[model samples]
Target: MLKVTPNPPVTEPASITDPTSPYECPDSKKFNEAAERALDYYLGPPTARIMAAPYCPNRLYMTNPKSSNESLLVDASETLGSANVMLNDFAALLEGTHRKTLLGIAQIVMLGELAVNQVLDNLVPTE
Candidate 1:
């Protein structure tokens, strides 16, 4: 009877047992240094090296650093008041949970405005 399958091809064993095999390096120190350099290049430093950007205020709408605290407080109060009014108007146009949420925010803004107004009232005018 004839065989359907052909005989397997013969092959040489791997050179792992040889002293100069590609698996073994003659200069281990150099190899280790190269590997470390490669790892450092790919993975970066062990510690974080993040560089923070220097603070530079926007020139277009930057607040004056020399502005009086009272003036700043007044501005803040006016902003909060406007925000509250806007929130109330928006809440009036909505219903359900969204309206309730907006109303709650408006109440908070109104409270903040009240606090600022109280501070303004307590502030003594400087000569």
Candidate 2:
């Protein structure tokens, strides 16, 4: 029987101290400063910011109630009509439960539209 042998280990001695070294220890302070500067350069705001209350309901709150109410009614009416058309189109394409559900939705939208129309008629009382 022949015996197997492993390769010998190799070792390199460390370099002695030199006055002029190519690499030096990294400066964490300088790195942090550079990172902060880079972040500021890329992420800084374009314009001066005025900080206000985060939860400001008055920002878009309607000033005139009566005029806004009328406009809202008209918009609701239009939205309901568009919804009815879409629902009808979908109902035509669907079957069974889906068809029935869509038809139900269409009926509800129509009822809402009629209610809005009645409210408008009562509010304006036009001949």
Candidate 3:
């Protein structure tokens, strides 16, 4: 009778009975230290990073930090007034619902301007 499969190879058992742990190896300790360094490099410190000041995206038209509150209010009021006038002019050129919508926006801007002016009037000038 012929055999269908080959016989398995016989091998001798190890003379030493104890198996060594990977952590006990000198190369494994170096690998562990390298892994720790990589982790520390990728992940920053435990504490949250603090910013000195808030970041501003636009550098072109930034308000002066030293400008007085009254001056800032006046600038805002003037801008709102100009916007209201432009809206009204544009509204005059249109007809029907579009004109009404533009006029509504203009009225809101005018209200803002009036509120700012009132605040300015109430504000006492600082010497």
TM-score of each: 0.53, 0.49, 0.56
Encode model 1's per-residue lDDT on 10-107: one tens digit a residue: 65443434555554544754687789888876698645433334556678987898999889899999999999999999999999999999999999
Best by lDDT, which number? 3
Better of 1 and 2 by lDDT: 1
lDDT of 3 by residue, 30-78 (tens): 8998999888755866443325345557968888989998999999999
Each candidate: what lDDT? 0.82, 0.76, 0.83
- Give lDDT for model 3: 0.83
CA-RMSD of model 2: 16.7
| Residue 36 miss distance in model 2 (angstroms) | 40
Cα lDDT, model 1, residue 95: 100
Better of 1 and 3 by TM-score: 3
Candidates 2 and 3 compared by lDDT, better number: 3
Worst lDDT window (10 residues) for model 2?
13-22
